[model samples]
Target chain A: MDTFVQQLINGLTIGSIYALIALGYTMVYGILRLINFAHGDIYMVGAYAGLFLATSLGFAANPSAFGFVVTLVGSMAIAAAMGMAIERFAYRPVRKFSKMTTLITAIGMSLLIEYLFVFFFEGKPRSFPQLLPNDNITLFGNATISTSQILIFVVSMVLMVILQYIIYKTKIGKAMRAVSFNLNSAKLMGINTDFVIAFTFALGSALAAAGGVLTAQYNPKIDPLMGIITGLKAFVAAVLGGIGNIPGAVLGGLLIGAAETMVVGYGSYIGIPSTYRDAVAFAILILVLLLRPAGLLGSNVQEKV
Target chain B: MNWVKSIIVGIIAIAILYVLNAAMSATGFFGIGIDDYQSRLLVFIAINVILATSLNLINGFTGQFSIGHAGFMAVGAYASAYFTVTHGKAIETSLSGLGETVASSIVLLLAIGIGALVAAIAGLIVGIPSLRLKGDYLAIVTLGFAEIIRIVILNIDAVGGATGYQVPGYANFLWIGIFAIITVVVIHNIVKSDAGRALISIREDELAAEAMGVNVTRYKVTSFVIGSAFAGVSGVLFAHYNKFLSTNDFQFIKSFEIIIMIVIGGMGSMTGAILGAIIVTLLPEILRLLPAIQIGETTFQFADLRLVIFALILILTMILRPQGILGTTEFTDFFKRFRRADKPTGGLE
Candidate 1:
């Protein structure tokens, strides 16, 4: 029972990160209908930016709550700018073309980001400096949780709440929703669709950056290629929850994360080895896609003639 | 008369291949020798042509996006490699009386058959269920299926698991080249047929195609299976020629590379696929020849930046020429246009 609870905690912690990233994927997909393949790389860029800020600004040497917040916000801002720049340059030029063209451009942007990072930083993994003091709290008999894990939960929850407020309460948020509903209609209604789209990218990128930094806290190892698998899994999560549905992305993320941890925690009894962990998300993805094409939360719209 | 002409053409092709093979061998054609690297490049180009052209059948002509082609390729490679490793020597010995070259050729043919058959079956399994999904959904599902296939292969100890697999080298440049030509020809002919028109119509509009009495699902599945079978054939050639197999070779990046080829060449254009294959194969090697730049105690190698360059090219291509270099037009179409332009006075017509 304790192990199960512990696994759930671990899974939810990972799931929260997936949710954060999935928000970005779902948001971009909502408005632009493009997968935003580079979104994952933006997460990586966020972590790297945080690393740069933390190290260069002496925050790594003197870890404090204030320092962590500053580093997090700074990285988020940098990633948001990068996201907007990417949309303006790589995506906007090809937006008028076929969906395939935009998709290919997104893929190209992803590769460009990954390889450019590899070129600049080398392919080796870097250990992210510990920003928070490490401590474990025993929740029950043989069940424990760490400070970093708690920090992940708290920060992600706070950010998600902020995201919710922005989406529901802000004028720009209304514009975003309007554009996503129908680009042409929104344009006719006097909404700046391009600005809304860019703002969506910025919001999504910032959230993904937060996820990256938070995950870096929990697991300090960072690498240039880390985003590919995590990003892919998050995308699967977004799809599972019915892509373009915000709440659905969060639900999918949590579900996928819990399932993965459960498999790792107890899959040996079912003849599945731990190394097959990477396959778990994809397997779930195939099953979800086959069973629920509209996703769990996404509504099925009739095809127009 | 048609049969006679086809037979003559087939014979001439075989003769040309035979002479080309002999020339590319260790000795030389006359005294001009093609080096190992050049021959290897040629062989890879042929294999990639088969891959790119086959993928084009589904992605370009049928307009069903499939990025899990490497998964099918891996299935064929591992399946045939296993067959040859287990029973190849026995078959070779059994056919020893036919002479060494003939025995090896027979073994290779059987291996290719097994590989293609197995991969086609895999295609059927993956395609039928997933073909119901449309556009980006289909793309992601295929990608997931490919990942699952790769993971499953990684777990199986029979094919050397993660350590990689070794098999007899029964493939050569001649066989790969011939198969490449055969694949392009078959796919081209299919595209020119009534079914090809149906596929083109589906690409243009799926609902409209179904309204026109086209069996949308069946044609999509058929094209997928055929494309996968050809991918399998390429895998067989790759495994035997390379004499080793690794799951790393069939990763998602490989699928992306194949997509890049078709995209760069012009998706629906057969000759464009061939051209794209050649360029993609040669681009990395060409990058290797670039000089390293020395800058203030640091030397930057252009070779290391090849992938970066490749990505930049892909993005630029999408932005500049979204239809790719050929835009659904074949190289032969250009020649026909040129000939018509030469005689602008309406000569024959």
Candidate 2:
């Protein structure tokens, strides 16, 4: 029972990060109808940005709540600017072309970011500087949770709430919704669709960056290619919850994360080795796609003639 | 008369292949030597042509977006490699009376057959269920399936698992070139046939095709399976010729490279696929020849930035020529247009 609780906690902590990243995928996909494959690399960039800020600004030398906050916000700002820049340059030019073209461009953007980073920073993994004092607190029945895990959960929840507030209670969020509903209509109604799209990318990229930083906190190893698998799984989560649905993305993330941890935790009894952990997300995805093609929370719209 | 012409063409093709094979051998034909590197490049181009054209059948002609092609390729490569490693020696020994070349050729044929059959079955299994979804969903599902296939292969120890698999090299440039040609001819004929029209219609408008009584599911699955089978064939040729099998070689990036080929060459254009295959195969080598730049204390190698340059090229291509270089037009069509001075037609519309 304790192990199950422990696994569940670990799963949810990771799930929250997936949810943060999934939000970005879901948002970009909502308005643009493009996967924005480079969004994952944006997450990696965010962690790297945070690392640079922490080290250069002397925050890594003395860990504090203020230091962590500054590093988090600083990286988020950097990643947001990058997101907007990417949309303006790479994506904007190809936006008018076929869906395949935009997708390919996005893929190209992803490769460019990954390899450029590899070219500059090298492919070796770097340990992210610990930004918080580490400690474990026992809950009950020998179950324990670490400080970094708690930070991931708390920070993600706070950011998600802020995101919710922005979407529901702000004018730009309203514009974002209008644009996603119909780009042409939104433009006709005097909403700046381009700005909205860029804002969406900024918002999504910021959230993803947050996820990246949070993940680094929990597991400090940061690498250029780390985003590929995590980003893919998060994209899967977005799809599993219905791609464009915001709440659905969160639900999908948690479900996927829990399922992955459970596979690692209990799969040995079912003859599944822990090495199959990476495959677990995809397996669940296929099953979900087969049963619920529109996703769990996605509405099935009738095909128009 | 048609049968006689085709027979003659067949004989000529075989003769050309035989001469080409001899020329590429260590001891050259007429003392003119083809270097190992050049021959290897030619062989890879042939394999990639098969891959691109087959993938084009599914993604371009059929309008079904499948990015899991390498998964099918891996299946074929590993299955055939396993067969060749375990039973190949026995089969070769039994057929040795026919001569060494004939015995090895027989073994390779059997391996290719097994590879194609197994990959086709995998295609059927994956295609039947996943083809029901549309567009991005389909793409993600295919990607997921490919990852799953890779992970599963990674776990299986009999095929050397993560250590990589070694196999007998039963394939040569001749066999690979023949299969590449066969794949192109078969796929081109399919695109030109009534069923090809059905596939094109599905790509253009799925609902309209369904309204017109096209068995949408069947044709989609059929094209997908055929594409996967050809991918499998390429895998077989690749495994036997390369004499090495690694799951790393069949990763998502490889699938993306195949997509890049068809995209750059012009999707739905057979010649474009071939052209794209050649360029993609050669681009890296060309990039490797680039001079290094010395700046201050650091020397930057252009070879190391080949992938970065490649990505930039892909992005630029998508922006500048979103419809691709050929835009669904055949290479011969360019000549026809030049002769007649007529407006070129036939693309997505």
Candidate 3:
């Protein structure tokens, strides 16, 4: 029972990271309908920026929790700017083009960003120094949780609440909602559609950056290629929870995380080794796509035909 | 006058390439037997040309974004490798207590056929569901399917799994060249056919094409199957030439490389596919020389930054020319004056 609870906690912690990343995917898809393949790389950039800020500035040796927050915020800010730049330079020119062209361009941009990171930071995985307590505290008989996991869960929940409020109550949120419904109509209504789209990218990218920082803290070791899998998995999460729906992304992320852990934990008995855990997400994606093209929470907006 | 000039130019270009191949081989440049390597590189370029051009049939001409080309390649590679190893002349002779040298003459075309068949089957499975989706959704699903196929292949121990499989090398420059010529000819014929026109119609507007009596789903599936089958054939060539196959070799990165070739060359044109394939394949080799230059206490090697620099180039190309280098134009189309001189006056411009 304790082991199960512990696993659940770990799953949720990981799921929280996925949820944050999935939010970016869902938001972009909701409005622009582009998958923004580079979103994952933006998260990677965020982690690296945090890593540079923490290590190069000597925050690693005697880091406080407050100092970690400062580094994270600054890194996310940089990532947000990067995301905006990508939108303007790589995506904007192809805005009026066919979705195929834009999709290919997005992929090219994803590759460019990944390779840029690879060039700057060698391909070797770098370790981030522990910024949280390593010691675990027992809750029940043996249901123990680490400080980092608790922090991740707490931060994730807090961010979700803040995001919920921003999306629901804010003026920009209203404009975003209007844009998601109809871009042409919203533009005629005096909404700055371009600014909203850029803000969406920046905001989504910033959330992903937070996820990246938290993931780095949890795993401690990261490389340029790390974002590819994380991005892919989050994409799956976005699809599973009914893309373009915020709450659905969270649910999808948790479900996927739990499913992945369970597969790794139990798949050994079925002759499928734990090493194939990476593939479970992809298989699930194919299955979901085949069975339910619209996804769990996605609405079917019919063609006028 | 134009025909004579065109033939002369073509002969000169081939002569130049041949001379360069010989000179590079004689000089031992780049330490990899440049002559042999260049010939081999040219063959690989042809194989890539075949794969990229075929993919363009679906992605560029038919207007579907299927990113599982490598999965089809894997299907073809393993299928061809299995057939050649199990039923080829060398294997049959060795099993009958005959020397490997005695069985060299009998060629096995079945390997290529089987490879393409298997790839087509895989394509059918992937395409059925994908026909319902479009754009990013389709891209994600195909990407997922490719990864799933790779992982499944890696876990299936019978096919050698993570350790990889090795087959007898049977491919040569002449055979590859012949296959390349066949690919170009076949695809060229297809592109000029009524079926090709239907595909172009779908690319322009799927709904309108459907209304105009074109079976949208059927055309899409046919394009996908044929494209994937060609990719499989390319894989078979690669497996035979390399004499080894691994699941890693058919990963998403390779699929991206092939896609880049199509995107850079001009998505819909066969000649553009070939042009793109050759340049994309050769650019990395060219970039290898860039690393020898030292920069401020740290030496940048092409091996380290090749992908990054290459990806940047891809981005720039897309930004500047999203339609690609040739933009659906054939090599002959560039020289309109010469072609116009021979054509009927006041024809379709």
Per-candidate iRMS values, in order, are 1.0, 1.2, 1.7
lDDT of 1 by residue, B1-349 (tens): 3335545664677678778788886677886767888889989999999999999999999999998999999999999999999999999999999999999999999999999999999999999999998888788888888888899999999999999999899999999988887787788778877889899999999999999999999999999999999999999999999999999999988998998999999989998899999999999898889888998988998889877987898999999999899989987666675565556543322
The per-prediction CA RMSD against the true structure, in angstroms, equals: 2.4, 2.5, 4.1
How large a fraction of the reference contact set does each model reproduce?
Answer: 0.74, 0.75, 0.66
TM-score of chain A of each: 0.99, 0.99, 0.97
lDDT score for residue B250 of model 3: 91
Q: Model 2 off-target regions past 4 Å?
A: B1-14, B337-349
Of 1 and 2, the candidate ranking higher by lDDT? 1
Evaluate model 2: give its lDDT: 0.91
The residue-by-residue lDDT of candidate 2 on B1-349, one tens digit each, is 3335445654677678778888886677987868899889999999999999999999989999898999999999999999999999999999999999999999999999999999999999999999998877788788888888889999999999999999999999889988887887788778877899999999989999999999999999999999999999999999999999989998878888888889889888988999999998998898778888899988888878867877887898898988678889986666764664476554633
Give the 10-residue window scoring lowest on summed lDDT in candidate 2 chain A. A296-305
Candidates 1 and 3, the one with greater TM-score: 1
**Top candidate (DockQ):** 1
User: DockQ for all models, in order?
Assistant: 0.80, 0.77, 0.61
lDDT to native, each model:
0.92, 0.91, 0.83
Docking class of 2: medium
